[model samples]
Target: MAVEVVSGIVLGSREYGERGMVVQLYTRELGRVGVMSYAGRGNDGAKLSPFLRVLSTVRVALRLGRHAEGMPKLVDVEEWERGAQRGWSCEKMVVGCFIGELIQRLLEERVPNEDFYLFLLERLGLFAAETQDEVVFLMVFLLDLAKSLGYAPQGEYTVSNRYFDVAHGAFCGRGEGEGADVIAGADAAVWGRLLDGHYLADLHDVDGSQRCRVLYQELRYLEVHSGLRLSLRSLEVLKELVG
Candidate 1:
């Protein structure tokens, strides 16, 4: 018996070989899957790259009465979003790859998150558009993703406070005649804006160093809350350009 399914293409093969190649894909239905194929070669090989959306109909063979391994086999492959690839429409292609790698690492394998898959698919579409502000775009993506992954920051804040508690993932409240132990003032303002899905672009009145500090603070919050470290290559690129 065999089963067939349509899955969203996440990432896959990027190697040259005799037969074909080994690729990894994050499918909406099957989660993370590995495929070995001889079909994608030359022109086909180029199309089989990471995030080259494709439709795969696979056949699963079960070994009975014998000690053997079982994995689904690809019976047919079809291009899904064939025209989605343009040059580098958004940030550099490398930055996009970095984002994809982060997603691939953070997401668990074989877990059902149809909503997340769809959200990611839409994000890819938006990233491809390249019309929006990339800095704001990344911050929005981070905040939304953080909330989804159970890292919604504690909103407790006050005008008199001064530091954000990274480990607690919250804005520390002002105490009696004193600021909170962690976050306060400008950091509180930034955190409040992030929680509200507001873009940081509006805060240009603040010094760039202050902005970078807030970004670093958020990064620490994400690390403590999600146990994932983003490569932040895009941030580095921005820093180099500014310097």
Candidate 2:
């Protein structure tokens, strides 16, 4: 009907035409939105990169009578955050891309998930801001993401039973639960901290490889529990690079 203008963050974009690029964005008001911009190339191409984190003041032309599906036109894109010019290690960049893809796949557009939206923004900003010690950040981000996705494993850690079955996301001591692997206290402590929201802010003193292991475990747990089929190529590359 009428054109509506809104502010949105550029989640990802790719070439769609000789000059136009299709952009996916997360808006505070509209959730995930797709915009096709013809003027998004060249010197401004930096604005279309994945996780460019730009804000667009867009003029949207909506199609009527398409309650569930229809393409909307986006006009007047503007750079909001200016995520360019910052140097990120390859691993950091990969992680950022992974986060964007994860959101794009798991989250439905037009539905409000404010908590998840805020969490993603914060975590992305954390990745961008932290120049050192990203392993901890990755671990913490995954754990928090699991919780948000409702796939967080359940457990309580005690001195008597400290090992966690990576698949179960729970503690299994000697002779306990069938098919449960022994859980280590260190892993349990890390998980326990996750329950407290401490893990989201930082991973403390853990090393890079160790962080990768934890991420693998958490992702495996999510795969088994949530059944969300996600490719780990980027994560695997990051792990090998850091290790």
Could you tell me every candidate's TM-score relative to the true structure? 0.54, 0.56
* Tens digits of per-residue lDDT for model 2, 1-243: 222222234343454322211223334344433443323434322333343443322232222222234522222222233244244444454455455544444542223255655666565555556445555566667767778766666676667666676666676675564553444657666666655654344564666666666667676666676665554443544455445
lDDT of 1 by residue, 127-212 (tens): 55553455555556676767766677765556644446666676555553232335567766766766676433465555657655
Model 2 regions lying over 4 Å from their true place = 1-85, 108-112, 165-168, 180-182, 193-196, 199-205
Cα lDDT listed for each candidate? 0.47, 0.49
Highest TM-score against the true fold, candidate = 2
Quote the positional error of residue 15 for candidate 1 in Å.
21
- Separately for all candidates shown, the number of backbone clashes (residues 3 or more apart, or on different chains) is 8, 5
lDDT of 2 at 185: 55
lDDT of 1: 0.47
